[model samples]
Target: MDKIISNKEKSYLAVTLSGDNDKEVIKQMASALEEEGYVKDTFADAIVKRESIYPTGLPVGEINVAIPHTDPEHVNNAAVCLGILDKPVTFNVMGMEGETTEVSLLFMLSIKHKEDQMGMLQKLISLCQDQNTLKEILAKDQDKINEVMTALVEK
Candidate 1:
């Protein structure tokens, strides 16, 4: 499989955020992504709408995670923006109506190509499923997180 995340892209991984809710967190992350030139300004609203309609929350063992993404039109470049929230935020679980999950980690995908989405998503799911990897991601510094994530994508 092709490498899903690049070293330059890994620099976009953020360690923490102060958002109190999903919308707030997404907005903040999207804005940061825009500033980094990874996404267009419209990405924030597009992702929020996508999340509301098709939530990305996944229950991965002890920690809940969310992968929020939108159509390729809103992307300036391809990169994964990782955000670890200070507190868990509620998000509706994928494929489950009316049920929600408390999410602490957010993976905001800015992909310029539509075809690469599924492959990258599958890798992300794999990463989430590994407890050891998740622990490393949650506890590591930005550089270490980038190293771990880069290694995962290259595998």
Candidate 2:
């Protein structure tokens, strides 16, 4: 796989929201990305809209994860902002409406090019499917998380 995410891009890793729900968590993550200049001012609202229409939640191994992203027009740069929720939040399963999963991880993608989204998503799915890899990611600190994710995306 090509390295779609660089170390600077992976620098947005965070552990967030034990007390908040899915919408709140998404807002928080979007705020961070926006502050970092990875996304545009309208990014948060766009993310909410996109996720509402096409939920990104997926059941990967024993853990549930979400890959929330909006159209490239809402992005200023390319990056992957990761959030590890302190507790699981419910997100409707992707491709399966009326069903939900408790999502603990979020991969908020900020890609400036529409063409790169699917490729980035494929690499993310590959990373999410590995139980050992997810465990390693969950156990690491922010710096370590960046290292782990960068390695995974690069490979």
Please name the candidate that would achieve the greatest TM-score relative to the true structure.
1
lDDT, candidates in the order shown? 0.78, 0.76
Per-residue lDDT of candidate 1, residues 25-61 (tens digit): 8998888788778888899999999999999999887
Q: What local lDDT score does residue 5 receive in model 1, on the 0 to 100 scale?
A: 29
Give all TM-scores, in the order shown: 0.88, 0.86
Please provide, for model 2 over 57-91, each residue's C-alpha lDDT reduced to its tens digit, 9 standing for 90 to 100.
99876778999999988988877777777778999
Give model 2's clash tally: 0
User: Which regions of candidate 1 are displaced past 4 Å?
Assistant: 1-11, 152-155
Backbone clashes, candidate 1: 0
How far out, in Å, is residue 11 in model 1?
6.6
Per-prediction CA RMSD (Å): 4.8, 4.9
RMSD of 2: 4.9
Model 2 scores worst on lDDT over the 10 consecutive residues at 1-10
- Look at candidate 1 and give me any clashing residue pairs: none
